[model samples]
Each structure stands twice: as C-alpha cells, then as structure tokens.
Target: MREFCDSISSYVSKQLKFSNISIYQKLNVVMSNKVYDLQYKCQLDDNVLVVAVCYFTQYLQTQQINKISAALNVFSTCAVLASKYIDDDSFQSEFFSDKLQIESETLSQLEMHVCQALQYNFALEQNQLVNIQQQLDEILVNNSNTPKMSFLEE
Candidate 1:
C-alpha cells in the first residue's frame, strides 16, 4: 500500500504539474504522528487510504479529465481519515484548501461528490469488523451467567 500510494502520488505530481506529492508526504507524516479521540470516523489506515486515492485517481484518468480538483477533494478526505486514525487529529477544512491547491468553492463541490460516492457511510471499514467482534464477545461474556440468547432455527 505504501508503494501504491507513492506511485499514485508520483503520478499525480507528474500529470497535474502541481505539488501534490508534498501534500501526500505531509498527510503521511500526520497519520504517523498524531492522535485522536473518536472511533467511529471514516479515517483509513495507510494501506486503505492509498488504495482509495488510487481508485479515485484511476477513475478520473479513465475519464480523461485534465482538472484534478475533484480527485484532490476525495484524496483529502481519505488522507484526513488516515491521519486522524493513525495520528489522532481532526481534519481541518483548511487542509483541503491549502494542501491540494484547490480553491474553497471547488473544494466544496468536490466534497459533495465525495459524500455522494461514499453514500454518506462514514463508519464502514475493516477495522469496524474488529470492533463489532469485540462487542459480540462482550455480549457473550455478559450472557454467560444467564440463559443463552439463542438464534431460532428454521
């Protein structure tokens, strides 16, 4: 995933002739260094963030869109999530404006598209599966001293 992220960042840097690589590097640093309190956020770990960015970028490339403002918005969301999860910092709206070289108006539109693409589902991920398993285990332990809660069979 690290390699993939690096590759995508590199590709974007070349294609856009914009300084997106530095933004990606900063995002990596933030994820590795910060800390957060919330658990239900949509932040990706490094691997998944990279994959998501690559997925979006590849989609844009296929469409032959010279403008990357939209892709950067999606990338910002993924990067912010990664940073929040790994580093524990909330993603500021300013980060989108400053890092991706996008203006406020364009960022707003991109944000809307990103939300639509994600179906407003911000808490679904592999890590959530772990959390769900933990909750289920706690339920089992709490029920151990009582009659079991059984699933009905057909």
Candidate 2:
C-alpha cells in the first residue's frame, strides 16, 4: 500500500512540478487517508478502493494537471465517482470537498471534467476490479518488510 502511494506521489510531483515536495506529500496523505475513511464511513465495499485507485491512475495519465490543486481535484473527484459506482451508498461533492479541504464548486467542476475525460465510461467489470485488487495485493506483499511513513503523519 505504501509503495503504491509513494509511486503515485512521485508521479504526481514530477508531473505537476511542485516546487515544494510537501504538496505532493499532502496530496498523497489526503488520498490515502480519505480512501480508507470512506471505506468505513460510507460502509463501502473493499472493491471501491481498488476501482478508485485505477480511476486515479487513469486520470493522472490522461489529464494534464499542472498544479497540486488540480491533482487534488482529480483525486477527490475520482474517489467520489468510484464510491458511487462501486458502493450502495455514495457521498456528495460537499462531503468529499470537506474531507479534501477544497471548495465544493471546484470539486463539482472537476467531477464534470473527469466524467468527460473518461468519455462517461464509469463502468468497471467485476473481473477488472478483481485484477486491480490482486495487483495491489502483490505490491503490498512484496514490500511488506519496508518501513514507511504515512503521509498523513507528516
């Protein structure tokens, strides 16, 4: 889990050219922390996190996010969409915006942009979600011994 988060943080940091690495760290913290929180808070299924990570990676690759704020918008929007698609209960933009410390209007706009970028294809087959979970599990197992810090703790 930590490795996956680190790779995403490095990728976003480089892509956005954040002058302060702390921005990327904060983004990583917010994403990891909130994803876990939503899993319990919304009574979301475990697959929701897998789908959210997949959507986040896809969004990062396809979108041109030039700032940390843009990256947060994308991440937060993806989380909301993923939960809606994967879980019985879904959170509103205001809920996620408060968690991410962003404005609700910005999150709504980003959600629209993300939906358009994805061509409105929000469906994830069961097998696809399973595969993503498997891959992430393998990563966690391989890096099990490595000591790491939660970005949230920093």
Candidate 3:
C-alpha cells in the first residue's frame, strides 16, 4: 500500500476535520476510507474500485437513502458487483459480511438495487470516472469526517 498523494490525502483528511457537513458527505468519507481498507485486504484492482465508486455514486442519485446501514450496504454491494464484473477471481459475500459486518442477504439486495438502478450497466468510461472523481473531490472538500490512513500512509 502507498500514500494517497499530498493533495488527495490533505483533502481526505480534511473531510474528518470539519463538522458542518451533511450526513451524505460524512458517509462519503466513511465509504472512501472503508474502500481503501477493503482494497488492501481483498487485493482489489483499481478497475474494480473505479467500478464500485461509479456504482455507488450512480445509485445514490436514484435512491433516497439516509442511514449508515444503507450507506454501508450500498458501498459493500458496489464492491461485490465491481469485483465480479471486473475481476477474474471475485470475492465472496461472506468476506464482505465478515469484514464490514453487513448481512450477506442484505448485501445481495443492495446489489440488486444498484444493478437495477443502472439496468446492469457496469461499464465506465475514462471521462465519466474523471468526472466522478472531480465531483467527489469537490463535495468531500466541503464535508467533514475523520479518516484514518490504516491501510497505507503517505
């Protein structure tokens, strides 16, 4: 594991520094930090992470979720989808359940929600990814939450 780079690292750490952001923004930082941990433990590829983030962001646009449970459900579900869609050796639900403490059935349902939200559209373009990153950067910069660099330090 490597560092998040100075710019992204500063922005991410700042997410935890402020206390005047919405719950959505707080969960975004949580999801971001959790994904970093999952990537290290699950040995996920950059492509899988890209797809996961895309799925998470798109699902949020269509759903009216407002709980940590729902947030983690979507976050972990997106990771499950991305790994299966993009990786040859995909992970199992039990792995996520064990790591994230979400039920396997719930993750399955959340997976269905995201897939249906996009009609099973898992493909992502470079421009779309760039746009997503920029959007997250802008939003996260304005948000506040503490993120630990447990996986890797810069």
Q: What is the TM-score of each candidate against the true structure?
A: 0.39, 0.65, 0.66
Pairs that collide in candidate 1 are 34-87, 35-87, 35-88, 36-88, 43-81
Off by over 4 Å in 2: 1-45, 145-154
Best by TM-score: 3
**Local lDDT at 8 for model 2:** 41
Residue 50 lDDT (model 1)? 38
- Order of the predicted models by lDDT, top scorer first: 2, 3, 1
lDDT of residue 49 for candidate 1: 46
For all the candidates, what are their Cα RMSDs to the real structure? 14.0, 6.4, 6.8
Native-referenced Cα lDDT, model 3: 0.61
Prediction 1 TM-score vs. true: 0.39
Q: In model 1, which regions exceed 4 Å deviation?
A: 1-4, 7-73, 81-88, 127-154
**Which candidate would rank higher by lDDT, 2 or 3?**
2
Cα lDDT tens digits for candidate 2, 94-149: 77777666788877888888888887888866666665555555545455665433
Model 3 residue 84 CA deviation (Å) reads: 0.9
**lDDT of each residue in 1-154, candidate 1, tens digit only:** 2332333344444444435767555544432222110111333343444334433444344344333443445566545543444454646656645555567677667656655655544454554434433433344445344332221111
lDDT of 3 by residue, 76-140 (tens): 68778888887766767788777777778877777787889878888888777776556444544
Error of 3 at 39 (Å): 1.4
Q: Kindly indicate the candidate among 1 and 3 with the higher lDDT.
A: 3
* Total clashing pairs for each candidate: 5, 0, 3
Q: Give the C-alpha miss distance for residue 28 in model 2, angstroms.
A: 5.1
